[model samples]
Each structure stands twice: as C-alpha cells, then as structure tokens.
Target: MSRPALEVADVFRSHGPAWRRAHAGHVSLDQLKVMSAIERCRTAALGGHVARCADCAYTSIAYNSCRNRHCPKCQGAAAKDWLADREADLLPVPHYHVVFTPPAAVADIAYQNKAVVYDLLFKVSAETILTIAADPRHLGARIGITSVLHTWGSAMTHHPHVHMIVPGGGISLDGSKWISCRPGFFLPVRVLSRLFRRLFLEKLMAAYAAGRLNFFGDHALLADTQAFATHLAPLRRSEWVVYSKRPFGGPEAVLAYLSRYTHRVAIANSRLIAVDEQGITFKWKDYRIEGHNRHKRMTLATDEFIRRFLIHVLPKGLHRIRHYGLFAKSACADNVARARELLTVAKPEGEPTSAAVDPNKPSCPCCGGRMIIIEVFARGATPRHQPTAPTNRIRIDTS
Candidate 1:
C-alpha cells in the first residue's frame, strides 16, 4: 500500500518539541513516550535490515518499527497478528456488537483517573453483560465477550467507551448444551443500561472511598466527600448508553470487524489530510448527522490537536483489549474445545493461521521474487551497502 500523504508522525516531528515546551508540566510521561516513539518509528534511530530480491536483485531498506501500541503506523501488523491468533476461537454462531458508554459527567472523572475508571469501565461493563445474560428470564447462558476500549470520538475528543463482540449464545448452566439466542437478538439494552449505571456508580464510589480515584483541575471540588456524592447523585438518575447492533453475517464477518477495531490507535495516518500553517486537517464523522453529510473535514490548531490526541494516551500497563466469561484466559482453551464440540463443528485444522507478510522477506516490486536480507544495521547506523545505480531499478521505502 502507498504511504499516506501525511501522518501523525509528520505533525509530531514538526511541532512536538514546541508543544512539549508549551505544555511543560501538564503532559504525562506516557504521552511523552508515545510522541517520541511515533517520531522515531521506522526511522534509522530504530535500526532495520536491507534486503535484496533473489531474482531481480532489487534492494530496499526496511526500518524497524517502534512497536508502540499507540503508533498509528504500527497497528496494521499488530491487528493482523491478533486477528490470526483469534481466528480459531470464533464460534460458528452469529455475533453481536454491543457498546457501553458513560455519560459526559462520568467521562470527566475518567479523564482524571484513567487507570482506575477505565478499569472499572471494562470490569463493570463485562459484569453487567454477564449478569444480564445469565438471568433466567434472559438468555440464561454464560456468554463470552471480547471487549476493546476506545477513548477517542471521531473528532479526536475524549469519549471513553467499550466495544464488545459477543457470541450470540453460550454454554448452558449445566454445561450440557450450546444455547443460542434468537436469530437477531442478544440482550435487552434498557436492562443492560440501568444495571451498568448502578454497578459503575457503586464501584466508582468504592474506589473513591479507597482513595483510588483522584480529582484535579475543575474537579478539585470532588475531592470532598459530600461534593462527590452530590456529583454522582444526578448520574444515578440519568440513563447510561448501551446499545447493540445487528448480528454479523458469520464468523468471517466477525473476524473482519475485529481486525479493524482490535489494534486501532486514536487516529489513523490515513485519516490525516494535510498539515500546514492553517493547522491540521483530517476527516471526522459527525454522528449527530445522518447520511453522507456526516462525513466532514475538520481543522484544529496544532497545539489543540496535539492536546486532544494526548488526552487519549492511556496509563502505562493498562490493557485496552480484554476477554471475559468463556473467553477468559483461565479456561479459554478447554471452553473453546467444549463449545466447538457442543456446536458439532469440527475443530479447525492446525494450519499456519497468520497471513501477515514477513518483514525480513519482502516481495520484489519489480519481479515478485522473495527478497533476502542482505545486511543488518544497528540503531543510529545506516546500511553500509547501497543499491547500485541502475536505470530500471526502483527504490522502495519498505518501512
């Protein structure tokens, strides 16, 4: 694929230093590290290998990726590998896409206590689903869920939400059968919403009592106990957002959906249009609108754009994707095996699952031949052997 005309790295490379100076004490260490990683990713600073095509003798330099989870340029390969690992686990049943979103008020607290609140967002949302699905009046089956946290809205604003991909059914309580839901339905959204709101608030209050929650800036008043209770009072009465989409066509469709969402950064390089004196221009979807009008271009001042992006830098070591219920790590293998057996579907053959291209063996653009690594370069070192000049030779930046 052709490189994007512009990238978040380009913006950071040009303005990051100045932005860092301007924000001085406000930026977090994780955000600073993310910026540095993106700037140096796929550059000589990370080192790489030089490859020569076996047939055409074509040569190219492919720099090493920083492999930072927040780097837009690095997620494509990561997502591919993750999807490959998960391909075998997909049940041959319809899957539902459900989203859990806290209101703006709660998002404010999440902004200040990301690690704590985001953890609750994942835990509480999963618990809510598990509770609802296991109720006798509901599906009465213990479902599995793969949840991914997304912290940015289409416009790069801080909108924390969890996207869950759930198999339409689960194993019965007795472990005797594979229980499936109605063809198009999963769980009641209203029930999920109310339970999520109550459980999240209860957990949030517990966290506050334990001093795990922090308050700063405009929320400093929330540090007081009474003030905090008052803050949460309105939220208890308000409705939280929980919605489910139509079921996917099949397991392939579910895998395709997971591929796009699993490793996505806050913004992708492809979404960037240009970086200029007028600031950064990028595509954003205004969900409040309908039809083609929802797709629009937005421009933000460089400083503001950088600030918005940094707001989404999650606390270090916090996981963005997690598995719950049957897919949980403790029993995933045995559970998947039982699920396949109950569904009466044969286990997928043990074949090579990954289709990601090996960076060390690139295809020759000229003759489609496998390229072998001719030389390795260390960090901050350039390749010693350059490709010889030939009129027909094409130079490619495989990085």
Candidate 2:
C-alpha cells in the first residue's frame, strides 16, 4: 500500500491548536484529547527511540504512537493484532455481510442521544437477526453474529449503522447438527428491515418514557411526551434500511473484510487529498449515485471537518465491535469449537494463541533484527556523546 500524500494527522498537526482555541469549552474532553493525540502521534512531541541495524549499521528514529482508537494512523496495527487472535475463531464456512441503518429522522435523534440510541441499535438489531433466523420459516438455527458499529458515512456525515458478519449457517436448536442456509442467500432483507424498524422504535419510545433520553438544540421540544411521540411518528412510518451483501467466498475473505472495517476510523489517512487556506479536501463516495459518478471529492472548512470527525468519537469505554447469539462472548469459543468438530475439521495446532506485542518496539530496516534500547533520553533531550564501542545492542534515545 503506497502512502497517501496527506493524512488525518497532518490535518490535525496544522490546524488543531487553532481549532481548539476557537472552539474552547464547546468540544468534549474526549474529542479534544483525540485531537491532541492525533496531532502529536509519531512526532517528537510523544518522544521516540533510535534503532540501529546490528549488521549493516543502519539507523532510524521511531516515535511512539498515540494508540487512541479514533486516530487513523493507530488503527492499522490495532486491527492487525486483533485479527491475529480472531484468526483461530474462523470456522470453515461462508460469512455474510449485513448492514442496518436507522432512518435519517431517527439518526437526528440518535445524534443527541448517542449512548441510548446506539445501545438500542445493537440490542434491537442483533435481536431481530437472531429471532428471525431461529424461526423455522427462515434459517431455523441459532446464528453467530459479529457486528461492528460505524457512525459515519463516506462524506463524514453522522450516519450510524451496524455492519454484521454472520456465518452462512448455524447450530440447530437441539445442538445436534450444523444447519446451513441455501447458498447465495442469508435471510430476506425485507423481513430483517421490518423487524429492526419495529423493535428499535419500540425500545426508543420506552427509553423516552423512562426519561433516559435527552433532546437538545432543535430537538429540545421533543422533551414532552406528546411532542416526542409526534416527532417519532414519521420515523415509525419510514422504512429502515437493512441490506445484506453477497456471502464472502470463504473464511479468509471474512478476515480481510474485518481487517479493513473493524478498526476503521471515520476517515482514513489515505482518503485525505489536500489541506490549504480554503479548507481540507478529501475523497468521498456518494452511495446514492452509481459507478464512477459515486466517487467524488468534497471540501469543508477545516473547523467543520474537525467537527464532523469529532461527532464520531464514541463514548468512553464503549465496545464498537460486538458478538451476539452463538457468537456472544460467553459462548463464542465453545460454539466455534463445536462447529469445527461437527464439520469434521480438527483445530489447528497451537490454536487460540495471543499475538500481542509491544507497540513501541522497532525492527532493524536492513537486518530485520529486534532493536533494543541501550540508552534512555527524555523528551526533547539529545543523546549523549559516548565512545564508539563494539556492541550488538542498538543505542536509543527519546529525542
């Protein structure tokens, strides 16, 4: 993958401080922290180490990463490490991709009530899929679902949706056999859509009645029960969007898709085109349009672009990726184990290994040897001058 000329970090490093000053007290602390982390990521501001190739005597400086989940530059490694652990969980079966998006009217309400609405989204959508799939009329099995929450559209607009990767078949209710759905078909999207719409609206109204939801700005009038009911009237009648893409070729395809979307931020660094006096320009897809016409560029004032990005910073400690039904964390491992056994496939050797590694460690560019830190330096401090000595360890400095 060739590096893009512009990156999300570049945008923040240039205009972040100015935007912070202008919008002081208006942004969330988490959003401000995200801006600060992105601006300083992999820069001297965060401190770093010097790594040298032991064989050929090549040297390089590697700065520490911010590791913020919202940082575009940080998610790559996070995804890679996460996928390593998930690799063992892949059953030898086809996987389906389904997306459930709330209507624009409900999306507006969800913007203000993010915690409640987002939680409801995951709950209702997962329930809808599980409930409908277990019915004899549909797949007639308890399916596993790995759902990821995405809150932005191609243009960085606030569009909340759940992307689900489901196995093509599931365990029968009696746990006696593996039940597979018809090839090239998962479930009827219309059935899923109607169930999702009805369930989401029901729970949302219940939350409103319990006073667990808050309305602000233009939606403040919805604080009243009658007004809130009236506000949701249109949403109730509107068709919720639920569509499933073609089933992936195999388990490997599912892994590839997970690597891309599971840890993705609202906008990747590669999508950024330019930043200038006018604004920041980036490529965006108009999904409403078709083919080449859908690929277009968009520019927003730097502040507005930052605003749009911040809208996607999820609440603290919220889990964006979740598993439901058979894939539910409580039983996922057991379920995968059983599924593999039923399919007459043996678990791979050394299955379920944790592939976690130190994020700051660097490898030699020429020799590919692990670089060791032989010296310590504080932020902005220069390395000390020392007599050259024959040693295998790579001398390092924070500066």
- State residue 231's C-alpha deviation in candidate 2, in Å: 1.4
Q: List the residue pairs that clash in candidate 1.
A: none
> TM-scores of the models, in the given order?
0.97, 0.92
Give me the candidate number with maximum lDDT. 1
Cα displacement (angstroms), candidate 1, residue 74, comes to: 0.3
| Poorest 10 consecutive residues by lDDT, candidate 2 | 390-399
Worst 10 residues of 1 by lDDT: 351-360
Clashes of each: 0, 0
True lDDT of residue 360, candidate 1: 38
Q: Tens digit of lDDT per residue, candidate 1, span 1-399?
A: 667788898899999999999889988888999999999998889998888889988777888999999999899889877887898899999999999999999999999999999999999999999999988799988899999999999999999999999999999988999899988989999999999999999999999999998888899999999999998999999989998999999999999999999898888998999888989999999999999999999999999999998898889889999999999989998999999999999989864534345643558887899888889999999898786455864465633
Question: What is candidate 2's lDDT per residue for 225-336, written digit by digit as tens?
Answer: 8998888888777778999999999988999999999999999988888899989999999999989999999999999999999999998878999989888889888998
